[model samples]
Structures are given as structure tokens and as C-alpha cells.
Target chain A: MTDTSATSAAAQAPSGVVDLLGLLAYAELVSFFRLSDAAGLAPDLAAKGELAGVAATEYRHYRMLHERLAAMGADPEAAMAPFVEPLDAWHGRTEPRTWLESLVKTYVGDGIAGDFYRTVAEHADAETAEAVRGAVSETERAEAVAVRVRTAVQEDPKLAGPLSLWARRLVGEALSQAQLVAAARPELAALVARGATGGDSGEGGSGGKGDLAAVSRLFAGLTEAHSARLEAMGLSG
Target chain B: MTDTSATSAAAQAPSGVVDLLGLLAYAELVSFFRLSDAAGLAPDLAAKGELAGVAATEYRHYRMLHERLAAMGADPEAAMAPFVEPLDAWHGRTEPRTWLESLVKTYVGDGIAGDFYRTVAEHADAETAEAVRGAVSETERAEAVAVRVRTAVQEDPKLAGPLSLWARRLVGEALSQAQLVAAARPELAALVARGATGGDSGEGGSGGKGDLAAVSRLFAGLTEAHSARLEAMGLSG
Candidate 1:
């Protein structure tokens, strides 16, 4: 744990918490909706039911974060409004045409997003970090997607090339959306910069150079995690 | 409750139970999916969340019925397979174009379907009756939809006309699909026919004329109940 004084100083800027939670809450809600939409494409009843079950879990997460925002006297809708466009755009740009593409998108897209949230949680207050962790903790469904995709690709080696290209497109679209979000929400960007500088080597230190370096490192971290996810699914990033 | 011997006679036909449970299971699952889809139309976050919560409840109902089917050694997929086409066609025919239309469909459509299931439950064996009753019992969400539609219509009386027509269309499409289902599933039709005769005047009587008369009474009962629902919604039949 960091020094108590340092934690208090960061906590003074609760807007950052609101920004993160708001973003995560909206993401969860949209993910729930999209997952249900994608469930329609499943080839069989079992797969459809499983995806619907996962979608329910996402709604639960959305509720938890939404309630937290309400408790803090924030309008959940107002807080989530900024995120609707960027996230919806990402979903629109990388629309999954088939059930396999849908599975890969969920696996790879959610994998990177969850990792980014966890990394950002480190710079947040304990409560915020814990909430973020809880919201993203349900990985069992992702494992199901991973196993199913891996098996499908194994059975048909031709699928790997198309799916790999799909994964790359998902990553590209996600990063573009992330850039839009960062450009629009400076508080969130500043928070990340602070998170990068205030930990370990330089406590409570930040600057433009530091922010740039931190963002680059964050991108590297997210990319590496995405590669690991792709590798796990027996595909190259 | 009817005579004990009469109940035992109906219990001999387990296929009817399987058919009922399978239809209810698939209905619950598809309702969950469609509700989530409709939630996207909600004007605000709270409404969206409420609809999503209702969708979750439907998922729980699906799980309950699905588990019971599995316990009874029925393949839920195969059992539900017959239903999918009819239900999908029903949803496709009466697709809601607006948020208010969606609410009316849920309020009126589900209201009638639930009533039918409950009516059918009377002929079901004790265990089957309880299960069907359980699956169709979550009416709190429907009540919410009713209140919302009623208030919206109260605020603007013009909605009453279109929504009333939409509700009628929903009922008409649902009945058409029900006819399709009855034509396709002989076991289900036999069960319904058996329900017709054994319920009222004759405790254990079965004849072609008697069965046809019973079906007429069943239709009348369903129509009457649907009229009551329309009245409750401040609309005409």
C-alpha cells in the first residue's frame, strides 16, 4: 500500500474515480446489450444460453457500479453519457458477422479492456479499485469462449488466418476508441498520468513528458496483454 | 383440484409435460433475449436497468424450467427446437417500432401468454402445474410496463390508438403462432384437448364433440381474459 498522505492527496480528485467508474459502468451495460445481440448468432441452444448467461453477469456488474455512482450523488445517466458514443462506435466499427468472430471479439476485446481497467485501478482509491476488480472478475465465461474458439480453429486450420486478422481489427478499433475517449476526457488522462508517475520510482510527481511516457507504457502493457490473450486462443496478434 | 383419478390419468402422458416445459423454457429464454434487446430503447438509465433486471428474472425462470427438463431426461434443445420457429415468427411479425410499442407488447402479449399457461396448468399433473405456474408467475415486470404505458397514455391520449392497435396485432400474431404450434405438436394439442373436457362439467369425459366444445370454451376464456388486459391498459379490445 502507498503512504496514507499520498492516498488522501489523490483521493481529493474524486472526479477521476467518477470518470473511471462511469466509463466502466457504461462499458458493462453496453457489453451486456451486445452480448445478448450476439447470442442470436450462436449455432446451437447451448452456446446461445451460455452467452445469455454471461450477458446477465455483465448487467449485474453494471448495476453494482451504477449503484455506487448513485450513492455518491452522481446521475448514472449523466456520468455514462460521455461514453455512449465512443463505445458504440467501437462496437459499430468492428461488427461481428459470424458467431466465431463474435466469440473472438468478446475474448480479445474484453481481455484487453479488463486488463486496462485493472491497471488503472492501481492508481484509484482502495474502494474504487476493489469495485473495478469486482466488476471485471467474471472470467469463467471468457474461458468458455477461449476454449470454444481454440477448438474451432484446431478443427479447421483455415480459420486461424481469418480469425487472427479479425483479432487485429478488434485491437485497432478498440485503440482508436480509447484515443477518442482520452482526447475527450482530460481528467481521465491526467489521472492515468498521475498513476504512472506517483507509483514506485517517483511518488506524487508528474509532467507532460511523464504523461507521454506513462501513456506509451500503458499502451505497451495493454498490447502485451492482448497478445497473450491471442496466443492463448492459438492465434497470433 | 379435480378428482384424484382424473389427475392420475393426465399424469400418464409425460410427453405433454415435456412439451409444456420445453415451450415455457424456450419462451423464457427468448423473452430474456428480447427484453435485453428492448432495453436499448429505454429513454433513461433507470428504465434500461429495470428492463435488464426483468430480463435477468426471465433467465432465472429459464434456468429453473431447463433444469427440470434435464432432470426429467429430456434434451432441452430438442424439446425446445419445435418452439423456436413459431416463437421467432411471432416476434418477427409483431416487431415493436417504438419504446411505447415495446412496453405494450410486453404488457399485453406476456399478459395473455401467461394467462394461457396458467389456464393450461390446470390440466397438468401436480408437479407440472407447479412448474408452469412458477415459470409464468413473475408479473411484477408486466405491472411496471402497464403502469408506464397507462401513464404515458394519460399524458398523451393519442398513444392509446396506436398502442391499442399494436396490442391487438400482438395478440393476433401470437394466436396465429399458437395455432402453428398446436398443428405441429400433436402431444401438446392432445393435452390441450384433454384440458378442455376434464375441467368443467365432466370431470373425466372425452369425445370429439365434447373436446371441440371444450376448445371453444378455452378460446372464449382466453379472449375474455385478453379483453380484461386491454381494459386494464386503458385500451379497447
Candidate 2:
């Protein structure tokens, strides 16, 4: 964390909005790249094309957040630099081994991340929140993921066991990384912390009681939304 | 090929038009995937993002071709399925080892591809030609590729040698696989053959004289264009 990054984040004040946008931007780009690779696992061309289309939506979101960062006079790349390792580590650790696993990751994994980004964005400045929401509004592809997974599970019930396990792994890896990020950048943790308590509790020192408590609440909501998503695919989340 | 595919191709008449659209669609998807992979080699985040933007253009073009196939009552997946192995082989063999090599492939390789597609599109039916032209018209990203490759070459003169060799290998691999595609789908060969000759020369048997002669001409023109592109980057074509 250089003073310049601190200043960039501080310039956007309420602290960590630049971090938020930067994190989201890098996440989108990585997601797009990963999903394109996952298309190879698709059963057919229709599935492959649909998967590529979904990934393209992620690139569009990246462009939006990237532009937002630049407009704020923050170097988009510099802001994003702080995030590359953690995100890459998370994706690396959770590489999906099959088409169903990939779908579950896309659905269960991206589902929660999108949910988490939205929860934090709502508390940022009006424009930041709007920009984040606009970038994050990728519901249609999520529907496509849902239909494919649900139908596949319905066809062969055996898939439910392994896929449900895969979803758990994806969520587990995600929270582990999220915690690492929170530890490294307390202000971001505090930003979401403020949203959860509707008070200034996260103003405490790094990884303080206030920060962990609020993040727990945020993650709790995300967990619930997608356990239901797993169940919708006949999987035990 | 199956009797059903032959019927479909026959229904399209001119034999190779379905093959053309399908080949083009699959090509776009594979190019998009390769470019996404190449983004990882970018020197900085700006270059990575720009590379990704070019990849997205390929996806949009893929969507365009896919939809056009469906509108013609042809299965988009089926049309693209046949070219999958050959296209995948070509990409796997020619993986770029550096950012400049990737840039050259995008600029010089895709440069000629867009040219060849446009040249042939001009000879197809009005709507088919229009659709092909629309998807293939990706000039802006080409400008991005040219500027980056040219600048990189200018700054470090030594890059020109290997990059020039890489461009030649790229064109070589492209022609070798293209010939494989031609051998497998004579109708498509005939389609481009007619485009080059401006006569009904490709109407003979598979691997016919007219087909080979015309394809040579089409490829000759593509080669000339990209040799110029390579020179523009201070490399010998």
C-alpha cells in the first residue's frame, strides 16, 4: 500500500471506494478469462457460445469500473495492482475439473461475489454505487448457468453429490481469500462494515472486532442466497 | 460428412456457403479465446485491457455469425463443429511466447484473415456478403495492434528479427491448416476459389485444378497484404 494508493483511496474518501472499484474491475477481467477457458468444457457449440457471451459481459463491466477509476484520477492499473495476487490465488486454488464443476463455480461462485460487491457498493457514494451496480448487473448469464446445471442434475442424479461438494469448495475458497483481502486492507473491510451495522463501527483499527463482525453479516447474506441456488439445482449446499 | 450435412450444404446451394459461415464463426470463437490467453502476457494493465477489448470484438463477431446461421434455419453449432479440430490444432501449435509475438499474430495474422474474409464476402449473395462483411470489419482493433507492434519494434530493434520469423511461422501455420480445411471441405474451397477467379472454375471434382488455382490466388493476395503489415512493423514478411 503506497502513499499514492492511500491518497487515491483517500481522495475518494470514506476510504476504500477506489479499492472497491479496483478490486471489482480486476475480478471482472479475471472472471472473463477463466470463463473463456471453461468454454472448452462445454458439451456443445451452443453451450460454448453462450459461455463466451457471458464472459464478454464481464469484460464490459471491467471497462466500466476501469473508466470510473481513471475518471477519478486514479491510475486504474495501479489501483488494480494491489489486487492481482489474491484474486489469482483464489482462482488458481479453485480450478474446476469438469463442466458441471465449472458451471457450479460460475453460478455459485460468481453469484456470491456479485452479491458481495453489490452489498458494499450500496454504501459508497451515489455514483460509485451506480457504476458498480451497472457493471455487476449480469443476471441473464446467471440464468443460463442455472438452467444448464438444473437440467443436468435432473438427468443424472449422481451429479448432485459431487457438484454440491464443488459449490462448497468454491464458497470456502472465496471466503478465505475475502478474509485475506480484509486483513490486508482494513479500510475496505470497514467500508462494508459500515454498511452492515449502519454505524461507524469499522472505524476501529485493522481487523478489529467491528470489521470482522460486519463482514460476517455480509457473507452470511451471500451464503444464504446461494445455498438456495445450489438447492435449486437439486444439490445440498 | 453426413448425408444430413450434405443436404444442409446443398440447400444453401453454392455448396460451401454454410461451411464458410460456420468456419468463420468458429474462427472468431477460437481467436477470442487465444487473445484472452495472450492478455496474460501484456506488459501492463493498459495493454492487458486493450488486448481483452480486441478479444471482445471477436466475440461480438462470433455472435453475429452464430445468429446469421440460425436465421438461415441452419444449426449454428453443427456448422461450427466441423472446423473445431483444425482451428484448435493451429492455435495450439502457434502459441505466442511473448507480448510482441502475440501482438504480431493479432495484427499480421488477423489482418490477413479480415482481408480474406472481406474479399470473399464481396462475392457471396447480398445478405450473406453483408453479414460476413459486418462481422469481419474489425479495423479499429487492428490499428491498436499495429501501433503497439510498431512502437515496440522501434524502441528495441532486436525484437524485429524473431517477431518477423514468428509472423512467417504464423502465416505458414495458417496456410497449412487452411489447406487442411480446404481438403476436408471442398465446397468451401470452391466458394473462395470462385471468389478469386471471378469464374465458375471451382465447379469441378474435389481438390480440382480450378479450386487449387483459385485458392492460391486468394492466399497470394492475403500474403501480400500482411507482408506489407510485417514491413510496417520493420519486419520482413
User: All models: lDDT?
Assistant: 0.71, 0.75
Among the numbered candidates, top TM-score falls to: 2
Candidate 1: docking tier: medium
Q: Count the backbone clashes (under 3 Å) in each candidate.
A: 0, 0
lDDT of 1 by residue, A1-237 (tens): 224444444446344667777777888888877777686788998778878788787788788778766655566777788988998898888888899999998888678657646655776557657766765677435877888889999999999999999999998888778777766665565565445344433233233344445555545555777888888898997
Please, what are the lDDT tens digits per residue for candidate 1 over residues B1-237? 234444444346444667877787788788788876687688887677777877887787788777666655567787788899888888878777788988887787677657646645786557656766765777545776778888888999998998888888888887778766765665565555445444544233233334444445545655677788888778887
Q: In model 2, how large is the Cα lDDT of residue A121?
A: 71
Task: Please provide, for model 2 over A1-237, each residue's C-alpha lDDT reduced to its tens digit, 9 standing for 90 to 100.
Answer: 133544454385567777877888888888888887787788887778878888898889889888777766677898898889988998999887788888888877667657646755766667667777765576434866788788999999888888888888887887788888887887787776565445565466435666667577556655777688888767897
Residue A207 of model 2 has an lDDT of 54
The docking quality of candidate 1, as DockQ, is 0.52
Superposed on all Cα atoms, the candidates' RMSDs to the truth, in angstroms, are: 5.7, 4.0
| Candidate 1 runs further than 4 Å off | A1-15, A120-133, A190-211, B1-15, B116-135, B190-215
